[model samples]
Target: MTRAEGRPLRADAQRNRDKILSAAVRVFAEDGLSAHLERIAKEAGVGSGTLYRNFPTREVLIEAAYRNELAKLCDAAPQLLESMPPKQALRAWMGHFIDYATAKLGMAEALRALVESGVDPYVRSKEMMLDALASLLEAGAQAGTIRADISATDMFAALTGIALASGKPEQREQAERLLDLTLDGLRTSPR
Candidate 1:
């Protein structure tokens, strides 16, 4: 199928792959690693063979689906900042982070097994998240909306704590208030 050494996917193949990834995310989110390949293919409207062609194993599919979801989250920071104030953008990203955490908790078992298999699906996760946070924090600092003194490491820890704490079902409201408080702490008060 290669028109050249690194040629792009044929249109239909690309479409099928996208469909499979989308279905994999939802199915995994709903049913975790036990979700079957046939069910995923059915949800994607593709054949099991097509799904296997795109992703030969469940681990590969899960890894791809996870990375895709992560890219979507990390990629949103700049777009959100572009369309809104940096402060609002940062807050919105926290919401995204919470969603990510919730999904992560659901996928925890599968991800752990993936780790045991010597494949680190999260190797670049912290770096990517830190980069996104740095970008937003830099913009907010330049705008004098957020404090410039906050370290990226510190911010990441805070966000991670907030995400884990608020990512639970019964504690979602508390998470919102905690997030607001956390954002307030980042704001530079008038001198």
Candidate 2:
């Protein structure tokens, strides 16, 4: 991956950056905005200097972690389609979406602080999500496994509703049930 300055990171540097972002997501989710950078560095198996070099500030780290999660979620659509049928791919992707939503919820406080700093961590998030959803819906429609009339915006809204209602760790079963119900409703022939 390229650095913010458009320079390509070395292999080791990219690995370190990935580790830092993964650790930052987990640490910030668990400890909120005031989590220690040293702890994140330790969790990432990287030095403090490495973390600081990759992300100079707490806001930068938080935004990077969230954007990393979002990128993974949106990128999963094509990967899932390659691995399974369109309907099944979409179903699997719903689970990923719920996981993403849960992580996003966990980082809400950190994200709020980032937003209050006059930076929008969510820039392009909605469009990116809709594009992913639209691709999945189009694939399913072509396969005749999903209804043709559903809009990506409507599907996104419904998924957001499901996430908000049952996206917690303890509520995963409920979330799965809700997702299945929603998916069933999207079928060409409702089950």
Candidate 3:
């Protein structure tokens, strides 16, 4: 709801921004970074002017879309914990991770373009993901459902490897199996 410069967006502006980001994610994933700005605007149900006001440029939109997806994935950790048992929450969060990975994979070209443009969209990505994983692991460990020996860093690396290996849509079955395997490894006892 706030701009990168920390200025709060008006409610309508926020809505438009959210729409544009969502649309951009889908559009970029389907059409790549060279996707037309007008197409994105139309997909968002906003005018070109509104989209321009919100994003300013293709790279800016790509970065925002990717960051938005990352935030959603990271923010799901506590919410998942609040709604389910810790181990269950971890499993559910891993599903969310797969979804995030799919989107990231879909936008790979767009992100590469953003990186080439001198903006590191992943600047806080690892830290945020690790924090989320740590919170979930700690909760599960305290609940005695998951091993306390696992480090968030280790889990993250494993998850990243799985994502890299099975991130495509057709590879979802394999990704789920890998996730289950990873979760099994994290369990205090095999279940």
Candidate 4:
């Protein structure tokens, strides 16, 4: 089949692509860049040929895996809102962000390869994250549960800092405590 730029994949091809990406994330998280593509294909129940057909190179696979995780994180905003109160939803999403940061750290080497190859995986990460957070925060503010003065950008920066600081296993407890403190600051004070 001819490769068309930005063309939608056929149904079965789309399923294969999804399987490969899911397998890649698991393998890369467990084994990093040293994880074999053939093994990923095996896990996805596809042949190595199919894996290569979907991802031409390891870097491509890595980028797709990272993007897939980001998509999951971004997609959770609405789901969380539907399941919990606005403030609780934002808190739960923050916890998920922490988990995402941890997983991303596990895939650091692969991410570095993307950077060396001139791809900026973080290009729109902040904007998308901020938009998601802004929606939740705005909802909370409307309910009078969250402070109105805090900007989504500032909240994101703070969360990123907390993620970075608590990235290490040894600092996990401290990081959690810090997260609570930050959340406390965001809460509306009783009059």
Clashing pairs in 2: none
lDDT of 3 at 23: 87
Taken over the whole model, the C-alpha lDDT of each candidate is 0.85, 0.94, 0.92, 0.84
Cα lDDT tens digits for candidate 1, 1-191 = 23236898899998888889888877877787688889999999999999998899999988887787788779999999989999899999988887777777767777777888888999899899989999999999999999999877898899789877777656778888988889989989953
TM-score of model 4 relative to the true fold? 0.82
**Comparing 1 and 2 by lDDT, which wins?**
2
Q: CA RMSD for every model? A: 2.9, 1.1, 1.5, 3.4
lDDT of 2 at 125: 98
Clash pairs of candidate 4?
A: none
Question: What's the CA RMSD of model 4 in angstroms?
Answer: 3.4
Give stretches of model 2 more than 4 Å off: none
TM-score of each model, paired residue for residue: 0.87, 0.96, 0.93, 0.82
Instruction: Name the best candidate (by TM-score).
Output: 2
Candidate 4 displacement at residue 46 in angstroms: 3.5
Give candidate 4's error at residue 12 in angstroms: 6.7
| Runs of candidate 4 exceeding 4 Å displacement | 1-16, 168-177
- TM value for model 2: 0.96
